[model samples]
Target: MLDTLSLYVAAPEILLLVMSCAIALIDLGVQTRLRNLTYGLTVATLVGVTWLCVEFALEGQTIYAFGGMVVSDPLGNWLKAFAAVAVLVTLVYGRPYAADRDMLRGGELFTLSLFSLLGMFVMISGSNFLVIYLGLELLTLSSYALVALRRDNANATEAAMKYFVLGAMASGFLLYGLSMLYGATGSLDLDQVFQAIASGRIRHEVLVFGLVFIVAGLAFKLGAVPFHMWVPDVYQGAPTAVTLLIGSAPELAAFAIAIRLLVEGMMPLAIDWQQMLIVLAVGSLLVGNLAAIAQTNLKRMLAYSTIAQMGFVILGLATGFVNGSTANAQYAYSASMFYVVTYVLTTLATFGVILLLAREGFESEEISDLSGLNQRSPLYAGIMAVCMFSLAGVPPLVGFYAKLTVLQALVASGQAFHIGLAVVAVMLSLIGAFYYLRVVKVMYFDAPLTATTVSAPADVRAVLTLNGALVLILGILPGGLMALCADAVLRTLAG
Candidate 1:
C-alpha cells in the first residue's frame, strides 16, 4: 500500500518485477525449443522499463520513495535505462549461444536475466545502507544462479561455487561494515549516517575500521586487486553468453552502488577511502595488464582486461575529492561514469563476437580459435577489431575518449602524486594495448583454423553490427553521452 508519488518514483522497478514474474510463469507453458514467446515477453518488458527510465531521467527530478530508502534521480534513471538496454542486447546475443548449448531448455536464461536486471535496478535506486545491501544480495545471488545454470558443465559448476563462496564472503564484509557504521552513527539511513559523520561526534578509529571492510567489499565487487581472485575464474569458466551478461550490465550497478555508498554516504571520510581506492587502482592496473599478456585463453584475457578497465574507473573515483575541496567532484565522477558506460558498450560487442563464433560442441575458448577470423567474416572481425582498438585507447574509438576523460580527471587534480599516477596509467595502458593488439594480429595474420564461414541469426547480425558501429560513432561524437553523465552527476550532487 504505497501512495501515488511513491508508486510513481518506483514505477519502472515495479513494472519490471511483475513482468519478470509473469514471463517466468509463462515460460512454464512454453514448449518451443526456442522459447520465442518467453523471450518476446522479456524483451517487451525490458523495453517498457527502459522507456520508463528514460522518461524519468528526462524529467530530471529527484524523488525519494519508500520512506526515503529508495531514490529516483537523473543519475539512477540513466544508469537503469542503460542497464536495461545492455540486458536486452545481451539476451539478443546470448540466445543462439545458449540455445546451442541447451542452456535455454527451460527459458531460464531469459527469466534469470530479467531477475538479475531487477537486482540491478534496485541497486541503482537504493538510498539506504540496508536497501543497498539488499539490492547487492539480490544481484549477486541471481548471478550465482546464472553461473550455475548449466549444472552439468563442470567448469560452470566450479565457477558458480567460487562465485557463491567469495560472493558470500564479500556480502558478509559489506554487511559487517554497515553494521559497524550503524553502531557508530546509530542510523541505517544514508542521509542520517552522512549527517552523523559530518557532525564528527563518532570515533574516527571505529569509522576507519568499518571503512576498511567497506572498501574491501567494494573493491571485490569492482574486481580490483587483492580481492579479485574470482574475476578471471568466473569469466573464463562461465558460458560466453553468461559471461557477457555478468561482465557488461552489472558494472553499471556496481558503479552506482560505489557512488551511493562512498561518494554520497561517506564523503565526510573522503581522504581515508580515497587512499584505499588509489592503492587498489594502481594494483589493478599493473596486475591486470601484465596478467592479460600472459593469458592464452581469450575469455581469460578479456577478464583481465576488464580488471584493467575497472582500474581506470577507480582512478576517476579516487580523484573526485582533492585536498578537501569538492569543487572538481562532479567532473571527476562524471568521467568515471562515462568510462564505465563506454566500457560496457565495448564489452557487449566484444563478447558478442565471441559468442557468435562458438558452435554446439566446440567452445571457442582459446586465443588460437580466433585465428584468421578476418578471413572468415570481415564484418565481425572488423567489429572485434574495433572493440580491441577501443579497449587499447586508440583514437576515434569510444575507449580512447573514456580513458582520456579519466586521465584528464587525474591530471586536473593538480597534485604531483595524481599526475604521477596518470603517467603510470599511460604506461600501463601501453602494456594493455599489446595484449589487445595480439588478438587483432591473430585475427588478421594467422591462418584459419577451419574453412567454415561464420554465420549468425539475422537479428544477432543486425544488432551486433549496430552495437559495433556505436562504439565508433560514439567515439567520433562522444559529447552527447559525456554531457549526459556530467549533468546527471551535477543533479545528483545538487540534490
Candidate 2:
C-alpha cells in the first residue's frame, strides 16, 4: 500500500483528481444560478496545483513513481506549470461565452478539462511507451468530448466526428509502432529501448519501422503538413474555449512526448530520424504558412500558424546538434522551447481578444468582422494589435526573439541545405506577417460593418488585458524565461 501510494507521486495530479470529483458532485446538486461555482472551484484547484508545481521546480527533486512509469523532473515541472497557466486563462476567457450560450453548467466540461490536464501531467512525466500511450488516449478522449460540448450545433457535431475518426487512426498507428518497438527491444521503457538500440540488441529493420510509425503518429498530433488536414476545420467548428485549450495545452503535451521519444527513446537512431524530421519540417513550414495567407477566418488562420510553428520546433530538434561541445546544440534546444512559450502567449492573447469581441449572437471571428475595431473598442483593438504584431514576429515582441533563436540555432549547426531551408522559413515568416498585419489594418483603418456597441464582460477584459500585457513584458525581459526554457531543455537532454 505504501508503494502504491508512492506511485501517485505528483501533488498536482492528486489535487486535480480530488477537485474534479468534488466539482462534479457540486455541479450535479447546485442550483442553476450557482453554475459559475464550478468555474471558481476549477480555477482554485488550478492555482493550487500551479503553486505546488512551482514548489517542486524550486526544490528540484526527481520523483519516480509506478516503478519508473512516471517521473517528475524540471522539464515536467515547468511544462505543468505552463499548462496550468494556460488552462486558467482559457477558463477566464471561456466563462462568459459559455454563460451567454447556456452551455456553462453541469461540470461536464470542467471535469473533462481537469482530466485532460491530468493526462497532460502523465504525458510530460511518462518514462515508458505504455504510460505515454495511456496519457495520450486520456487527453484525446477528453478533447473529443470537449469539441462536441455544443451538441446542438451541427458544425460542432461534424467537427467532433472528424476529429474522432482522424484521432483514432493516428492512435492505431501509434500503438502498432509501440508494439513493434516492444517486440524488437523486448522492453517498454523508453530508457531501456535506447539502451537496447545502443547495445545492438534490437533488430534494425523492426526498430526503423517502429520509429517511422511513432513519428507519424506524433506528427499528426503536432498538426504538421501532411497530417494537419483536420486542424482548421476542428478549430473553426469547435467552441472558441475548446479551441483555446486544444491550441495551447495539447501542443505542449506533444512537445514533451517528442522530447521523450526522440531524445531518450531514439537517441541511437538520431541520424535517421533527424533526416526525416527535416523533410517534415520544411514541408510543414511551406504548406502551413502559404495556406494561412488565404484564410478569411481568424481561427482558421491561427490553425495554420500553429502548423507553421510546429515546423520550426521540429526543425530545431532535427539538427542532430545535441552531442557537440559547441553552443549550437544549446541554442537549438533553447530556440525550440522559446518558440513554444512565445506561441502559447501569442495564441492565448489572440483568442482572448476574439472572446472579448464576440457578443450574444455574433462571434466576431471573421476577418471582415474586425473592421473599425479601433473606433468601437480602443482597448480591445490595442490588445489585438499587440497580439497581431507578436504573431507577425515583429521586433520588441516575444515572437521575434523566438524566431531569431530558431534561425540562429539552425544556421549555427546546419549544413548548406539546412541553411537554405532556414532561409525559406524566414521568407515564410514574412508572408505570414502580411496576413496577421492585414487583420490589424482592418481593425484600425476600415469602417465598421454595423453600429452595434462593442463591449466585453469585466472578467473577459481582465484576462485579455493580462495576456496582452504579458506579451509585451516577456518581449522586453525575455532573458529570465529564456534561461528557464534553456534549463528545462538542458535537464531533459541530460537525462
Candidate 3:
C-alpha cells in the first residue's frame, strides 16, 4: 500500500481519478436537460487539478512516488498544470459546438475528456516504460471514442476506425521497442535503463535497431511525415469540437513523452536518434507545408500545419547534446519545451475562433467559409489573424520567438549541419507561411459567404480573448516563460 507522503505527491492524479468516476455516476442520475451540471463539475475538477499542479510546481522538488513508477517534478507539474488549463479551455470552446449538434445529450464528452486528461497526467509523470505505455493507451482509446461520439456520422466513424487502427499499430511499435530496450539494458525503469546504456554492456547494433522502431512510434504519435496519414483525416472527419480536443492539449503530453523516453532514458544514444529525428523533421517540414498549400478544408490545413509545428519541436530535440557533449543540452531542451507550450497556446485560440464561427447544422470547416470574417466580427477576425501571424513566425508574436529560440539553439551548437538544418527550417517556414497568410487574406480581403452573426457565449469570448492576448503578451515578454522552461528542464536533467 502507498503511504501518506507518496499519495500526497500524487494527489492530483488521485483526485482526478476519483472526480472522473464520481462525475460519471452523477451524470447517470442527472436528467438529460441538466447536462450543464456535469459540465460544471468537469470544469471544476480540472480547475482543482490545475491548482494542485501549481502547488506542486511551487514546491519545486524532484520526488519519486510509487517506488519510482511516477515522478513529482517541475517538468511534470508544469506540463500537468498546462494540460489541465488546456482541457478546461477546450471544453469551454467545445460545449456550444457539441450542443448545437446534439452530441451533448449525455455526459460522454466530459467524462471521456477527463479520462484522457488523466492519461496525459500519467504520461507526463511516468518513470517506467510500462507506465508510459499504459497511459498512452488510455489517452488513445478515449480519443477514439470521442472522435466517434457522433456514431451516426459516417465520416466520424470512419475517422475513428482509422485512428484506432493506426493508434494500435503505433502502440505496438512502442511496446516492441521497449521490449528491445529491456532485453538490451535489463531494466524497465528509465533511470536504470539510462545507467545500463551508459555502462555500454549491450550490443550497439541491437540498441540502434530498437531505436528505429522507437523513433517510428514517436513519429506517429507526433504525426510527423510518412506516419501522419491519420492526422488530417481525423481532424477533418471528427467534429470541430473533437478536433480541438485532440489537437491542443495532447501536444503537451506528447512533449512529455519525448522528454521522459529520449532525454531521460536514452541520452546515451542521442547520436543515433538525432539522425532519425533530422530525417523526420526535414520530411515533416517539407511534406506538411507543401501539402497544406493545397488544402481547401480549414481543419485539414491546420492538421498539416500541426505536422510542420511538430517538425520544429523535433528540430529543437535534435539539437540537444551535440557531438556527445551535453554542454548545450539545457538550452536545447528548454527551447523545445518553450516551442511546444507556445504552440499549444496559439492552437487553442485558432480553434476557438473556428468553433465560435460554427452554428447549428453548419460546420464552418472550409477555408473559403472564412471569407470576410473581419466584416462580420472584427474581434474574432483579429484574434484569428493574430493566431495566423504567430503561426507564420511573424515578428512581435509568440510563435516568432518560439521559432527564434529553437533556431538559435540549433545555430548556437556551432555545427555546420545544425546551421544548415536551421536554414532549411527557415526556408520551409516561409513556404508554410503562404497557407497561414491565405487564411488572413480570406478573413480581411474576401467577401463574406455567410453573414451570420459570430456569437459565442460570454465565457467562450472571454477565454478566447485571454488566449489571444497571452500569445502577444508572451511574445513581448517571453523571458519569464523561457526561464520557467529552462529551470524545469534543468531540474529534470539534474534529478
Candidate 4:
C-alpha cells in the first residue's frame, strides 16, 4: 500500500482525478444545466490543481512516487503551471463560442480536457519510457475526441479519424523504439539507460535505431516537417476551441516530452540525435513557413506557423553540447525553454482573438473575413495586431526575443551553417509576416462585407485582453521570464 505522505506528494494529480470523478457525477445528474456546472467544475478543478502545483514548487523538493513512475522537479512544476494557464485561457475563450453553438452542455469536452492535463502532468513527471508512452497516449486520445466533438460536422469527424490513425502509427513507432532500447539496455528507467550508455555496454546499432525511431515519434508529435501533414487539416476541421487546446497546450507538453526523453533518457547518444534534430529542424522550418504563405484560412496558417515555431525549439535543443559539455548546452537549452514560453503566449493570444471574433452563424477561419475589423471594432483589431506582430517576430515583442535567443544559441555553438538557416528563418519569417500583416491590413483598410456585428462574451473579452497584454509585457520585461527559463533548463539538465 502507498503511504499517506506519498499520496500527498502526488497531490495535484490526485486532486484532479478526484475532482474529475465528482464532475462526471454532477454532469450525469444535472443533464439540463450541465454546461454551467461542468464549466464551473472545470475552472474550479484547474484552480485547485494549479494551487497544488504552486505549493509543490514552493516546497522545492524533488519527489519520486508510484514506484518511480512519477517524479516531480522544478521543470515539471514550471510546465504544469504553463499547462494550467493554457487550459484556463482556452476554457475562458471557448465558453461563449461553445455556448453560442449549443455545443457546451456535455461534460465530455471538459472531462477530456482535464484528462489531457493529467496526461501532461504524467508526461512531464515520468522517469521511464513506459510511463511516458502511457501519458502520451492519454493526451492523444483526449485530443482525438476533442477534435471530433462537433459530431454533426463531417469535417470534424474526418479530421478526428485522420488524427486517430496517424497518432496510432506514431505510437507504434515510439513503442518499437522503446522495445529496442529496453532490449539493448535491459532497463526502462532513464537513469538506468544513461548508466548503460556510460558503461559502454550499449551497442552502436541498437542505439542508432532506437534513437531514430524515438526522434521520429517526437517529430510526429511536434508536427515537424515529414510528419506534419495532419496539422493543417486537423486545425482547419476541429472546433476552434479544440484547435486552441491542441495548438497551444499540446505543443508545450510535447516539448516537455522531448526534453525528458532526449535530455534525460538519451543524453549519452546526443551526438547522433543532435544531427538528426538539426536536419528535422531545418526541414520543418523550410516547409512550415514556406507552405503557410499559400494558406488563406487563418487556422491553417497558424498550424503551419506552429510547425515553424517547433523547428526553432528543436534547433535550440540540437545546438546544446552533448555529454558533460555545460557551457554551450546551458545556453542552447535555456534558449529553447524561453522560445517555448514565447510561442505559447503568442499562440494563446492569437487563438483567443479568433474565438472572440467568431459569431453564431459564422466561424472566423478565413483571412478575408477579418476585413474591416478595425472599422467594426478597433479594440479587437488592436489586440489582434499585437498578436500578429508578436508572431511575426517584430522588434520589441516577445517573438523577437524568442528568435534572438535561438540565434544567439546557434552563434554561441559556432555552427556557422546555422547562419544560413537563420537567414532562411528570417526570410520565411518575412513571408509569414505578409499573411499576418495582411490580416491587419484587411482589418484596417478593407470594407466590411456585412454588418454582422460580431461580439464576444465579456469573459472572452477579458481573457483576450489579458493574453494580449501578456505578450507585450513579456516582450518589454522579458528578463524575469528569461531568467526563470534559464533556471528550469539548468535544473532539468542537472538531473
lDDT string, candidate 3, 386-492, tens digits:
99999999989999999999999999999999999999999999999999999999999999987776887889999999999999999999999999999999998
| Candidate 1 lDDT for residue 11 | 94
Ranking by TM-score: 1, 3, 4, 2
Candidate 1 lands at a TM-score of: 0.99
Per-residue lDDT tens digits for candidate 1, residues 299-368, read 9999999999999999999999998899879989999999999999999999999999985358888999
Better of 1 and 2 by lDDT: 1
What candidate 2 gets wrong by more than 4 Å, as runs, is 4-8, 320-327
Report how far residue 213 has shifted in candidate 4, in Å: 0.7
What tens-digit string does per-residue lDDT give for candidate 4 at 306-332? 898888999898978734574788788
Would you list the clashing residue pairs of candidate 1?
none
Residue pairs clashing in model 2 are none
Residue 104 lDDT, candidate 2, scale 0-100: 68
State the weakest 10-residue window (summed lDDT) of model 1: 356-365
* Global lDDT scores for all candidate models: 0.94, 0.84, 0.93, 0.84
RMSD of each: 0.8, 1.7, 0.9, 1.6
- Displacement of residue 24 (Cα, Å) in model 2 is 1.0
Which sections of candidate 3 miss by over 4 Å?
A: 32-34
* Deviation (Å) of 220 in candidate 3: 0.9
